[model samples]
Target: MIADEIREQIDAIGIERGRPLLISDADEVLFAFMAGLESYLQGEGLSFDFSSFAITGNVKDADGMALDREAVRSHLGVFFERHTEALDPVEHAAETLAELSKEAQIIVLSNIPLAQRGARARALARHGMDYPLIANEGAKGPAVRLLHDRAAAPAVFIDDIPHNHASVRDHAEDVHRLHFVADTRLARLIPQAEHCHARADTWLEARPIIERHLFGG
Candidate 1:
């Protein structure tokens, strides 16, 4: 089961006691996935509708007809396979996380395919975010709980998806949740989640908010 696999991966990471844990999502948190993906799609003569958050319905060909679900999925796979290690870091993500890492244990919880995990790790390392990366699938509630169980109290979860934030809220209510969406246009489209402590589009604004919650600064 996915939950068992995630638990094994978390246990293998060997959490440090007496330190706060920061579980962050990679796409739109540490790296610009939507932006990079858009560029990649453009190259393939396809584009997004920008009106919907879901990719399958949003991705369209030059004729403006939405691509089939399978085609969209295939395009995503190809995009990740070829461009996983070449993504641009979200603004101030590396610097802010590096500062936070001094006081907290940082772990990247991404929903990328397992095959691209190596490339994602290499990319983060290249961007000076050499932290432990965990590639997961489906809802992140169970995995977040496992990580929280191993770390000190007052853990923080940073992600762009409201569902993931809600999952953490349901599974680990004590953990602080930060809803981060890096793309300005996309951020405007997303409503603030009731469970999130704060919703931010840039790390500059996010850093202070997270610091206050985690360190009481």
Candidate 2:
């Protein structure tokens, strides 16, 4: 179960008034996570075993033995502590989010450790793309539900995780779900989704779909 403190913090950051066109997700969706994580691990004498899809126990050192789940989690905590501020946004992400904010109430819904939210938001703001960022924990369905309640209708959820996308599909039947995989390597691994309204690898490619669905362009 997610802690009340974190949920309250997330709720405080969500879009509260009027119908919203919420566009969110932080790692991989907005800022690169896999690449940054890999680099951080390498600096710590650890590394990803392949370019394949997996994290935690799947990652390993050069010898090919898995890093074990606890070590992986510890590494991630340290990495976020040191490097969350260094995350670089995907190309055109700032402009796209800013533009979308003008047309609709843009709120960022992200499932990251609560400790990293402040640094993440500050980093995003430093890049000129700050918006209301939620530091959600666990499955995103409940968080999406909260957004749905606030926005009423015309909510659009964008994320890179298949599970998170599925969560939204289950909770918000009317919301438009966009599966956005910005990393070239991970994009290929994202399975085809019948529930997804659109699958995009770049903001440039997705702008048309977002404009059409959100604004009837």
Candidate 3:
């Protein structure tokens, strides 16, 4: 399932080869996605409940009622379309990744719609994260596996979603998983996944851990 998706995207963008691959997620891990989404929602006269980890059920109206799943999905599309290029980078993400790139091949694996790929790439590059960006959908296990196959061991995976971490854990067991969420408020709301090597809210904390895991420092 993910092989076909990976083949399609990799064929389009082409992959770079290097030792010790770092497959990372853009939202939450590198960019402040939930924070941007919340601000976008506020502009639309909506806001998140922040009480729940999931977005679909947590997005609320002025009357404090959750929007239907379809509505939330539609709003997400609009949010990305309007704000993807301008979303702020998570603290220390650009600097840490720039440093880490010297030691490992850094590839951003984001679960964003394919249409926003160019915009996202441009945005990341503008923020000094000019690494390869792969826009994918659904579970990231197969994609991570394929990426790992291209580079030397040990592959590292970083994402905010537990399900994505679980996917890598199941399909690419050797890949080190780092569960990261940039927003402090939302970070506290999320529970750490058992499959992850470490759960971090900032790149400052995660950089040392990842460096140690991959470089044996």
* Candidate number of the best lDDT: 1
Which is better, 2 or 3, measured by lDDT?
3
* Tens digit per residue, CA lDDT, model 2, 1-217: 4467656865676455665576578887789888898789888777686555568666787788888889888888898899999988888998888887777887777777788889988988988777878887776777777677767657788888778778778877777888888788877765645677888879998887787777878
For model 3, residues 18-83, the per-residue Cα lDDT tens digits are 477788999988888888998999999998998978898899999999999999999999988989
Q: How many residue pairs clash in each candidate?
A: 0, 0, 0
Return the TM-score for candidate 2, rounded to 2 decimals: 0.91
TM-score of each: 0.96, 0.91, 0.95
Instruction: Tell me the deviation in Å of residue 194 in model 2.
Output: 5.2
Runs in model 3 lying further than 4 Å from the true structure: 3-5, 11-18
Local distance difference test scores for all models: 0.89, 0.78, 0.87
- Candidate 1 has a TM-score of 0.96
Those runs of model 2 whose alpha carbons end farther than 4 Å from true positions after fitting are: 1-3, 14-16
Candidate 1: where are CA atoms >4 Å away? none
lDDT of 1 by residue, 1-217 (tens): 3466677778789898768889999998899999999999999999988896678889998889999999999999999999999999998999999899899899999999989999999999999999998989987888888888878566889988888988889888889999999988788878886778888889999988888877889
